[model samples]
Target chain A: MIVLVDYKAGNLTSVQLALAEVGHESVISSDPSVISAADRLVFPGVGAAGSAMEEVNRLGLAPVLKDFVATGKPFLGICVGCQIILDWSLEDGRTACLGLIPGGTEIFTPGPGSKVPHMGWNHVGFYRPHPLFEGIPDRSHFYYVHSYYPTPSDHADVLAESDYAGVRFAAILGRKNLAAVQFHVEKSGAHGLRLLKNFCAWDGGC
Target chain B: MLTKRVIVCLDVRNGKVTKGVKFAGNVDLGDPVEMGAQYYRDGVDELVFYDIMASAEKRPIDIAMVRAVARKVFIPFSVGGGIRNLEDMREVLLAGAEKVSVNSLAVQNPDIISQGARAFGKQCIVLGMDAKRSDAPGLPSGYEVYVQGGRKAMGIDAVDWARRAVSLGAGEICVNSIDADGTKSGYELKLTRLIADAVEVPVIASGGAGTPAHLVDVFREGRADAGLVASMVHYGTYSLPSIKSALATAGIPVRSVP
Candidate 1:
């Protein structure tokens, strides 16, 4: 069963229903044991970086998540979940992150006439081939609502990219057994469901 | 690049959508959840549900309804009306709302905007202003702010209040023109431009939208970030695909429905 990590953040029902739409039955739990034993793990969040990390640590699921990644298990993070996996974030101020990936997050300071919270559907450009994105067309649009994005030290981790306010930040990332997308795949309509299906069938070694 | 958004607003009362003209005469629409899901399927960029009866009942937000709609719709959903404190905001967000819009409660307690932003990031808070043109002079167009579904006027300058709300940590603002609502003439362009220029955040122009060209004018002439419509969409006067195509043809950067 797919395990959805709930940290008292934003909506999880949509994620649950989206999975169900794809004929997948997942359980929402913050329990480390269930997450560790699941076939795949999904971390979905929509909020600040500091508060989300605090909840992860409070539930003592941080170490469990690290072990899950170390085990080469399939894992995915969405929006704020993707940001928390970075080394740190500079939102309200500088704050530490999950350290799963080597990099830090920065707020998207758009140029003149560009909106801050890049909230809308934008096209995603594939950078490298990955099984998680199988059958998903290049330049396919996905729903996004965020002010901050991650900047990894290694360019090899990027799986896809999207442009907003003249800045092209990383939209999807994957290295070994772990993978995550900055956009809300659950909210991206049919293409989103196809992406989820691809992830569920992916072998972690890729 | 920022794309122009087309939104559908639902006046949800007791879990059912009730449509009216100038917020006076009421007519029952269909179920809120079913209508919300229909809009989502039709490729609406976002959905906003305003709880018009929460304050009259003196209860918290209708979280169950919010959850019901959120569970079915994949796009972003925002809930407004009767949100007074952080607890109320938390309940709505937990119930699947991406953002919480404050109307009457926000006017009564402006500090609640800051408090809500501090507790649950700024992007989750939207300040909704109901505006109407006044006959009095000394004010440009005599813009007066209204609250409680535009039934009462607050006598406050709409421009000044919009500036204050942005300063108090409102991430976005929705200017709903009560005079032009249900008229379908077009958006109050002058008022829309005034507020859009007054604040730094994205401003949504609500009310008086009949045709897709009107939406194009609001985005170009009024310089609004988004446009909100109700009757025209509900009554089947326009389809989402055709409207988006018209906006794209007009050189407005709008996401086409796939």
Candidate 2:
């Protein structure tokens, strides 16, 4: 079963619904035990970084997540969930992150004729081979809604990239059993569903 | 590169998709969730849900409906109309909405934008503006801002209001043209360009979209990040796949169907 970490930051119903649509059984909870025991874990978020981290700390899921990652179980992070895995975030000033991956999150500054927030659907170009993007075509568009992005310390972890404001930022990252996409695969239409399906059927042997 | 977006909006009222010509006469289309899901399956980028009756009812957004749509639709969805305060925004976000859009409420209480941004992050707060050309002197169409689904006009310049909204933490802006809504003619290019140039946030040019060419024109000529339309897509006037194809052909990069 896939365990979806719920921190009361934003709705997890869409993620749950997407999992269901792809024929995967998942449970939504903040309980560390469920996360530690599940075959795979998904951290979904859609809010501020500081507050979301606060919930993770409040629920005592931080250490549990770290342990889970250490176990090499397949892990996935979406949006702010992806950002929280970084070393830190510069949103509303600097704040510590999960430290699962190196680097930090920084606000996007769109150049001339560019727009902030980078809302709507944008293409995701794969940079590295990973099980998470098995069926997802290269340059496939995914729904994105965020103002900050992760700059992975290890370029080897970079899995995909997307362009915005004249800067091509890292859009997907993965190393070993851990993987994540900054875009909302849950909301990326059929191609997105395929990504989730790939995750469910992946045999990463974590 | 970030591809331009072609969005099909569903202005839902009484659970049915409805569209008003020039934001005036209302006509029913079909089921909101079904139509929305169809668009999703057709390769549309994103979807917007505006409860046309929310302000009149003076209530929060329709959480149950949001939940229903959010259940079947996996793409990012945004909810607008009657989003007055943080509580309202929180409820909808909890109900599965990725973003909550505010118009009159944000105008009435500008701090709500910053507060929502502070709590949820700037990306989750979207400021919507209904604009029209004013005939007054020293002002471009007066650029008067309208509220309550374009029923009441606020004598504020549209350009200045957009600038202020961005400063207040609005990550994106949806500039709806009251003069061009449901016209099927095209988007208000001049108006969209002015607002897009004024704000650094992503501007979605809404109202008066009829064909694929219209979407192309707005994204290319107007330099809009996205185009929002309702009636045409709901009534089967244009299919999502054809639109994306046309956009691609026009040299506007779009995500091709898998």
Tens digits of per-residue lDDT, candidate 2, B14-42, equal 87888888776798888888887788778
Off by over 4 Å in 2: B137-141
lDDT of model 2 at residue B238?
A: 74
lDDT per residue for candidate 1 within B155-208, as digits (tens), equals 788998888998898889999999988888999998998898877788899999
Query: Looking at model 2 chain B, which ten-residue stretch has the lowest summed lDDT?
Result: B135-144
**Residue B219, candidate 2: how far off, in angstroms?**
1.3
The DockQ-based CAPRI class assigned to model 2 is: medium
> For model 2, how does the per-residue alpha-carbon lDDT over A123-188 read when each residue is reduced to its tens digit?
888887777777677888888888889898888878899988777888987878888889888888
Q: In angstroms, how far off is A122's CA in candidate 1?
A: 1.9
Give all candidates' CA lDDT scores. Answer: 0.86, 0.85
Q: Largest lDDT belongs to which candidate?
A: 1
- What would the TM-scores of all predictions be? 0.94, 0.94
Candidate 1 versus the native: TM-score?
0.94
TM-score of 2: 0.94
